[model samples]
Target: MTGSRGPAAASAWIPLVVTVTLVQAVLALMSRALPLFGMPLTASSGMPPEAVGQLSSATSLGSMLFFLWGPALLVRLPSIRQLQLGCAVSAAAMLFCAAGRWEGLLIAAFGIGLGYGPSTPAGSDLLMRVTPKHLRATVFSIKQAGVPLGGLAAGLLLPAVAAFFGGVDAALVTAAVLALVAAAALGFWKGTVDDARPAASAASPFRHLLLAPVRLIGLLVHAPRLRLITAAGFCLGVAQGVLMGFFPVFLSDHAGWSLTAAGAAFAVLQGLGVGGRVVMGWMSDRLGDPVRALSGICLASGLTMALLASIGPGSSPLWVIVLSSLAGLTVVSWNGVFLTGLAEAAPEGRVGEITAGGTFVLFSGYVVCPLLMQAVIAATGGYAIGLILAGLAPAIAGLALMIGAGRRQR
Candidate 1:
């Protein structure tokens, strides 16, 4: 089922909320850990800082591959089982990463990302069954807020742990322990949460794999709402990719901010993003239309990015903080609203599969847009042109959605 309108007892969906939220947090911690600990991690691993980014790229590639093929696995494994497996894989990846060898880090990064692949589709599958339609955006946003919280933990806790415990290995081990404990804890909730099983398929896994891309394309082609939202998601991903992936670097290298100052600005952006998700969720619920909420978000995000791209050495620090806060409020906060709309648009019995397909497109933006941005930067010898293009993508998408909504109303 997509969603229902009646009020639901908290008991019916609260457990699902907790389960999915915890899973999101774990995934965020694992992925964000690499960037936060990059200096020490690269130094200890005997890899250059630039080379460490390749590991992150590897992780994204792994996630995209799994998302493409996830529906096949969903036919056999319940969402709860998927979550458990994701956590377990992440735990193992962390341990492997602790080896501090280049080859090991490459494998571990990809493994952790593969583990993260199921997070949205699986979580949405579980939540949509129990969560009321009225409360859908709020609930999903609450779960997604765990991402910013996990990132906050990475920024605040990991550095301290590394400092007190003597190095990067201790921090890696600490993250691994958390993943294992989360996996074990999930086992208790399995029977209760895995109430809905995916319909079984007669096709072999190989056959299913072969058909995955075709199936996803067919879904998008048939579902107009899903296609629109998926495209918007890709555009939004470009802005988000630029901000989260390169914001600090931009502030330090282009804007002439100190490393500590740049890091503080980043924290402001991420910290405010937690509250932003919740607020955006409430707005979406009140508006009774996730699309409108997302349109506004994209517009705001584009505005913020444009403003940020204009900042340079002589710009005021207060202005930088303001822009960062706005970026956090819009760019990072759009995910929950976007995901809720995607879940609502999903056809019956195919929420997980459709979500996997949509996310695959969205993840493609994260992987591809930055490369384009780099090319723009190389050609222009300045950051402004690239950032402007990033902002323009979402602006155009938001305007298109708004116009489309208007025509439909007419």
Candidate 2:
């Protein structure tokens, strides 16, 4: 049993990992392009503070809709079919964004968010089924790193495309083309979907939320240490979202840096995030406790973020770049650790349910941060206070994890 099972598991897992990673990378690139598009709209339309908040909320709203509905649908559809459909929808959405109409762009953003939302949980499910217990953390981390890598690629390449083409629309069109190609590739890949149906006697999504394992993982996320992890993620998202959402404005308003330079800098952060995930994952696997590794990373990330905030507006651009890269590294590492921990915590057959539930909670941070941070900035008249508050969130989260670790030890 052991001999045959080991090789079989490896074959099954490797392809799924590769496909999901590619899909995530492509989606991240697409996501990076949206804020660049929105910044100009905010500038040109003379959008009010509230309008800015709404625009930011639109992405999260789209994600929320997907988060709410995706799990139910995952049970009904085959994983491959779901992925294929998601990629197709994402392709169409990107094309819509490329069309450059205001209504079209909004629709595209929402559609893309909805499409991408299912891919993670669904992919995670697939990974869990195929990967052996011992290798789960390593494989999951490698897969999740694709997010940052994609974001990095988008950050670096999209702006250059926009510069050469002389408009954001061209970059959007390029992204659409890339997504379409990815979808095409996925369509041709051969694999069985990991379709673990909920028992016939199961309750609805809300009811499932109350199930023992699901509730345990959910509480785990809200646990003091995990709460800090989520909060750090929230702050990271805010910093990242703001930079992606409005770095052009920052460049134009405060720094003499051009749009291209600012965009590249933003991309650098995303690129570094890939390395962060790998380092964090390796540490988690070797240290034999994901929670502790996550806490350490968050602490490092929090300190870096505070340092970044302390670098005043007119400070050296090099300092901003350095801090941003460090923040990206530490901030993005938490996802892999947390997700793996949640999966590990689940009861056997309920892995899918627990993972999906945990992801729903984590994504809430993504949904809420952009809009909330923007609102705070609008109210406060300066980003300094907002950034400072954001920086502290991760530190608190890390401390929570330390306390939890101590409790578990005792």
Candidate 3:
């Protein structure tokens, strides 16, 4: 993508990593910007919370759609262009969000999600190709750290920008400028960091779209191991979705913590996740078997979820923070390791396709789990009931991964 036709030089990793990490951070910021940016956008535009939900749904659906077809587009476009395109889409989304009414925000959110869709998989495709095998997990984890760092940035920067600009316009513009700068930088670089495959041959786009579903179904039906692993990833997604959606509320509502305190706790959880991803990733590499190591981590994090569920309002505040930290470390840290594990297990040369498929299933959790958690909470009228169920997700995932690893060993 950057270079002519050659693979990226090893020394190019520094800028490449920085650029991709920034991409991740930007997308992460967008994903988390709802309360920060979303609130202001809604207020200024006179949109209701229900409208915001529709906007969020649009984003997630856009992401899922891209995850399904992103790699195909990747093949058709230069990786550099792909990276820049993702940023551009997000830029457009942010601009629309800052100015557009509810309808505009809904469309903008979809653009944002679709734009972010190709980033990780494309980045992963590059990392797996460029980095040495031993370093993949650590390096990927470093890239993955962008998510938490992005969250941290949104927390620290967006508010000040909004306050400074006296509106969300200046903040969104700043975000857009950052993405454009990154995209421009990659364009100027002479290295070929992303030119992995030849452009898609002259073929009808519809033919490509028509065949995607058939090929996807075939990929799973023909590969039982991949299917099981994908299913397990879906479970991880459920655990991730539930906790991400519910943790702050649970802290405030059930644990009787103030909103500020709960938000602070959530920030700490995100901070911990930044370190947790690296630690878990390094451990997976050191153990030399990501699947088994991830299994253990999943089990450990699941226990922390259970611990959180057991902590009622009368429980010590410090203990809740402690358990939250544990969950943050174990549950939130799994993505890099999980991505590495999925890559390791993919059929040779099929990593990109598998990554797309796995991501689709993973995102399904984001769509399904929170709704399920909400229903469970509503039915039981207790946070613990839903949380206990959330706790089971990772445990189930660990079991599935452990069994899969054992079968591979045999």
Candidate 4:
């Protein structure tokens, strides 16, 4: 009912998809680069390394705040406008976060987070509105690849740029400019795919905004499938957050690898993720049930986490690279399929709402994982505890998804 159907639908969605993907990539580059971006501050200003956490957590907090109200914004505004607003905010926030010090850093990080808040719900709304159902999984997966690609650029490209132009300032400025360009491109889209609004509902706009939060909470509480899937999101988030946040350090400190080797391993992991998203998403598309495919990926992800836990200093570097890269493919990949399945699970016209709710839980993992990892490490007196926990979480998530998918089959 929302997207154009047949031949027009396929062609129409491409430009929006490219726009949304670029926006996601730039935002991701900005956020993913934060810890890396802050290192110079730690070195020069003697800012505590802990300060990076504040910035990172602030971004998560900002995202949560957006999830609280972002769905409601889509209820009235077109997804493109919401997306453009997000881009503007992200561009400014990237610049602010890069330049600001101390309190400024925290505030800017929060702003960056806030800027990210609308992207998933708005992008999901836009994609689902315009994308034909048959192509949704593959196309969305391809779009989702932007996540890893942005990260790749951050890990690979930004460092190269920083070496000459120097530091995060130049890189952050580049991200900001791209964010503005993404916004400008969207402004020129001129499509009506989801631009039309229904006649004024019985409820006033103010009322819709006021109660949207309540509705979202209630939906999470009552929607059994969604609740299960979101819980899985939490599990996946914990594993992902820990994997990304700590893998490099683990390799350098614990595994006795050189910094360059650790970085290359991280790059391999991310590169695999970029390809895996599309491949898994395509498989999901063909399956006619993305959740089933997602379950298998989660299951594989758990297995890979278990493999990582077994990797120790005694292991060969070649063995480490192979296992670690596989871990990347399984753990870091699969978001596209997962999110596509989440949107598909929702009732029509409600993808935005579902995505917002789901993304909040996903981000909650980001907020909680650091503390959780520390606790697990302290309790067990080892990092192995963290890896085991990550392994178990995704395995449980896989089982939950398997059950959910089975029930749907019935």
Candidate 5:
């Protein structure tokens, strides 16, 4: 095990990390594209702006379905090949979006999400094999940073491309081209990375697909460590989803900030989130306990989110900016550490299965919590109650994790 951390190992893991990061970044960009371009897209499609929500729902539906069956695909295809197929599907979907109408947008959004689904489990499968145990958390953090990186690129570059070509279609086309190019580039590494794929299952592929989610849930149910981390993932993911999904809206509605200012603050939060992931990962490595790092993050997230909920129109921009940055560090930065813990606890030869299952659990928070937040806002006619409850979730989870660890030690 010690010898596996040598220069030869470095040679392998470094490229794998870079490759996985690239895939993650591309997936993130594709997931965000339609929403970012919604104004122009809806205008041209003769649909109301609210239709974007329908498109988003379609995409989320596609992604959840893929998460359920992702492991079955891994059983038949190597992780790299799965990634390539996903990219190809995304590229074609983007093309459809660029060329077609409202119906096309709905179909394309779902396709893009389906294509994005392979990223976590497949990337984890590749990286877990080569990453050194000592550096696992930090490396995973670095790769996870690609998500924010992709968001940044979409923010800066997509608008420019849309403006330069005089339409959103150009932006869509450019993204499609990038996905296709990424797929082609990965081909060069397939021979190197695909050698360790599990033997193709002899069972019926459709049967295996239908049972994948059930099997994954069973794996999670029996593993106490996985169960704990999955709960943490869900709680933290709620905080994250609430922050990202509603931060700008909350600032505009309650904090009395202009939409532009709110967006700028949101960007600051996202930018800081990138740094937070790396820092937390490094801390996990130093502490030799990713769970401790996650606990601390959740605690901090709870505090900052509570403070954020209290800000009103009269609040200073400095307070809003500072709190948003803190939210980035706490709310948006937990994924890598959560994933590190997940990979570490996964059964041997079952990392992909466990990752897919855990991801499904975590992602459910993203779906359910936002709706809950909306409900709170509707009932109370204010954002504060919803935001505070969101903050409280991770705080409790963090305390629970701390107590659980202490009990295990005793």
Candidate 6:
């Protein structure tokens, strides 16, 4: 077993994780607030749905660009420095978002995406470099939990801030200020950690990502188990986007829950996801095969979501709460296992590239799922079909992972 280290070494990562988590949470809340901000812009300026989609996609596009190029750039720079740069960029993006102009919003989205995009792979690399392999899964789970934890924070806090302040713009500005503070903290943080060495001299980010090794890794990421896990992530993203996107409508029209209640419920659901992530990660570590743990969680989550859909509107408040909590737990629990597996499977010296490649593919699911869910809802006149379809996708993903795990065992 890898022995435990000194407190100074272990505690080194605490501040970084906390800052990243807070940034992510604030960004997510801001992202959710975009539609509200966009409504007036769309109504007055006649902005096309496609343009709105572009604005939404800007962050992902920036992330894609960063992931494709960041590995090589970061190889030369210290991980802490890279994180600081990312934080600065993210802060600037938020400032632009606060400007409240349509063009500014788009630019801000792109900036934020580019700035924060490298955090995932960069952070993962740092954790791997410092933490022992045996504890890697658990550490990663704790780190990954930040995503849901941030979501929960946004769910609970942003709405309250917005409500109290009389608009989301004020809340966004406040979030931006916080991001700036985090960036400052990152910039000044002093920690001693080894840096990853690159295999070759730097090349164009686009070229590096398209090369054989990276492409091969990207293809490998589609292995049955990984594919299923990624698909589950996609489904979860869809559920998140749609549930949050149309939440007010759902509450008023179907559930008869007030906007305040809906907001509170959404916060609770996201908060529960934090626990889910930790539990799933711990279980995966103890079970010795993260894939199996992932499969179980995905299967359970999918079925529970389906049941929630079946119950429909006007279900008991208690049932709604229970279903939402279960869904949160299962849906958000897959990332640690999936990501840790990807990190482990990567080529000896190309872990960053492999991680970037894998995450790029996985995030594609996020882009597609929401659009599909909305289309289904529009066509069917309710979320029932969409929810059922979403449920099945994860189950299929679970089966794929089970097969992949079997193959590995052999």
Tens-digit lDDT string for candidate 2 (82-118): 6667767777777665444566666777777776776
User: What are the Cα lDDT values of the candidates?
Assistant: 0.78, 0.65, 0.70, 0.74, 0.78, 0.63
Tens-digit lDDT string for candidate 6 (1-410): 22123455566656545655555555454454443333333434466322344455566667767776676555567666676777667767777665556778778777866876766777776666556677777767777776666656665666677779866667666666656676666565444443333345566765754564466455565565445545555544544444444443444445777545666666676677777777887888898776677678767767865776755566888887887777668766667776787777666655566667667665565556656766776678776776777677677766776777788889
Clashing pairs in 1: none
What is the Cα-based TM-score of model 4?
0.87
TM-score of 5: 0.87
Find the 10 residues in a row with the least total lDDT in model 4. Answer: 42-51
Q: What tens-digit string does per-residue lDDT give for candidate 4 at 263-332? A: 6677677777888888888898888877677678778888887788876788898888798679767887
Model 5 per-residue lDDT at 201? 69
TM-score of 6: 0.82
Question: Clashes in model 5: which pairs?
Answer: none
Distance (Å) between predicted and true CA of 263, model 6? Answer: 2.2
Q: Which structure among the candidates has the greatest TM-score? A: 1
Give the residue spans of candidate 4 off by over 4 A: 5-7, 38-54, 98-102, 192-194, 197-207, 252-263, 310-317, 374-382, 403-410
lDDT, candidate 3, at 86: 85
Quality of model 3 by C-alpha lDDT: 0.70
In candidate 2 the C-alpha lDDT for residue 73 amounts to 45
Give per-residue lDDT, candidate 5, residue 146.
74
lDDT of 5: 0.78
Backbone-clash count (model 1): 0
